[model samples]
Target chain A: MLEVKNLKKSFGDRVILDGVNLTVNDDEILCIVGPSGAGKTTLLRCITGLETPDSGTFLMNGQPFDPQGTKDSDRVIGVVFQDFNLFPNLSVMDNITLAPMMVLKETKKDAEKQAAQLLSELGLSTKGDLYPWQLSGGQKQRVAIARALAMKPKILCYDEPTSALDPNLRQEVAKIILNLKKSGMTQLVVTHDLDFAQEIADNLLKVKPID
Target chain B: MSLNYVFEILPSLFQGAWLTLQIFFWTLVVSIPLGIVVSLGLTSKIRPLQWILEVYVWLMRGTPLLLQLIFVFYGLPIIGIVFQRYDAALVAFILNYAAYFAEIFRGGFQSVSVGQFEAARVLRLSYWQTIRKIIIPQVVKIVIPSIGNEVINLVKDSSLVYVIGLGDLLRAGNVATSRDVTLVPLLLVALIYLILVGICTLVLRRVEKRYSYFK
Candidate 1:
């Protein structure tokens, strides 16, 4: 379970996320929706330790989560950016296996074995040798998910995942997230695409702007 | 002017080129990795360390190589730091080129996106792993052309070591010209530089092609 109590963040004199509180259970999809610049992404960043919050206590499985030091929480939480942010220089297989081999101390053969399985599940089996630049937006998004999944995180977080997709591809991303959820992966999606959000979210959190 | 005269100068020219090659080879062998270390210092989180590296880079860029060569060869002995002619020239060239290469590397490091670091952090990669696997390979691709330009410049700049009486290729040409009263040695030196730079351009182009997979 993940819980945030009175999470507050400010940039200079501008307040982004103002005294927000929320709780998320295991294997649940929680969607955060709000107007642009209302700090929805900031909240997600704060949770992932990408951005430091001014004040808040975050807990995952009853342990305090520290944003500055991801030592204990990196494996517990993963993020997929809207842009995908895949390593352009590496082949798909290399990208997916990197974290496992480096962080988990798995042998290359073992990591690749797991990666091959994950790629097949994500329908990227045949595309493993290709670089990220060669993939379509939808394909890149799927690879990003596979890359995150390779870490075996308890919760996967996404930032405006569908914002860059064509309207035709939005449904595909929604289905992918739903599939992960069905497979017992907890998720927190920050997106403006509410219809896509509604299709996957078991619960919703609204982030309101402060004057 | 005669083919026979050019042939007579060949041995001397080759000897000079050989010495020039030595300076070039030694400087490149040491400076590339040293530049990376200095670049890391420049980007380190410690403000004082960063400032120190910044000032070092600044001083190196601010002073002329000629003055540096002269100082290392001549002035250092006053401080009980005597050096051989060859070693003094090598030290000066490596320090100067290392500074240049460090600046070029800094540009390469900064060219990488912030997203790369964030992704690495989220993936639980150690800081060294992130740099070794993720950042450096990408930076190499981005800065190949910039580094290539500096290397070609190094070939031309290697001639400056003659100022310290190191007897490099240009110095050999000077001796041949003064002794033989022929312009052939100078023209030969020009051709050798062209060949060296041509070979480098080809290698650098192949590197750029290999990295084309990314962009």
Candidate 2:
């Protein structure tokens, strides 16, 4: 479980996230639904250590969580960016295996084994040799997920996972999120689509822009 | 214009060409990596270091290469920092080319998107690992054409060693031209430069092709 309390963030004079509070339970899907510029992404970024919050406390299973720390936080919190920022220079296999081999000090054989497993699980078993630019949008999305999951983070966060997809792809993403939840993976998805949120969210949090 | 005269000066011109090649080869070997380090320094967070690099780049780029060569070979001895003629020319060439390459690499570094860095950060890749694995390959792809241009320039600029009385290709040609009172050696010198530049272009194109596997 992850808990965010009294989170606040501002850029220059404009406030984005103001005293926001939320909690995500283990093996649960928490979808943040809001219009554009509602700080939905900001909240996810703050939680994942991409953006710093002005004031907040993050607790993982009741222990203080520091996402920015160099310890286990990196392995504990994984994020999939909105655009699926896979390393363009690397093949899907390398993209999934890079962090595991480089940061976790896993042997290349072990990393490749785990990446192959993740790729198969994500329905990209045949696409591992291809580069990110060669893959379709949905395929790239799956690769990004595989890359994130290879790290074995305790909680996975998505920034507008379906924003760039078609309706069919959106349904596919919803199915994937539901499937991940079934496997006991905690997920926090930020999106503007209320219908999609309603389709998969075990709990929904609506954010409004701070005027 | 006669083939006989051309043959007569071929030996000396070849000797000069050898020196030119040496200067060009060593300058590239030393300066390319030095340029990368300087470019990283230019982008680094240390304010004073950045300022120093910026000023260094400005001084090197803003002035003439010819002037720098003269300063290193002639003027510096007045301040008791003296070097041999050949060494002084090399010092000037390396410093000048490094500055230009540094700017080119700095541009390459900036062209990479912020998302790449963020992704690497989230993956827990160390700073050096991130630079080596993620950032450098992309930057190398982006900067190849620009770096190729500088390399071609370096070939021609290596002739400037003639100013310090070094027996580089152009100096050899000049000496023969003045002694024999004919322009044949100068024309031969130009042809040699074209061949060198052509070879560089081919190698650079092959390198660019190798990197094209992704984008």
Question: For each candidate, what is the lDDT?
Answer: 0.88, 0.92
Per-chain TM-score of candidate 1, chain B = 0.97
Runs off by more than 4 Å, candidate 2: B1-5
Give stretches of model 1 more than 4 Å off. Answer: A67-74
* Tens-digit lDDT track of model 1 for B72-178: 99899999999999999999999998999899889889989999999998888889999999999999987788889888888889998888888888888889888
TM values, all candidates: 0.96, 0.97
lDDT of 1 by residue, A78-121 (tens): 88988888998899999999999988888999899989998998
Docking class of 1: medium
Question: Could you report the DockQ of all the candidates, in the order they appear?
Answer: 0.76, 0.82
**Second chain alone, TM-score for each candidate:** 0.97, 0.97
lDDT of 2 by residue, A1-211 (tens): 9999999999998999999999999999999999999999889989988888999999999888788878875358888888888999999999999999988889999999999998888888999899999999999999999999989999999999988887789989988989999999999999999999999999999999988
Q: How accurate is candidate 2 locally (lDDT)?
A: 0.92
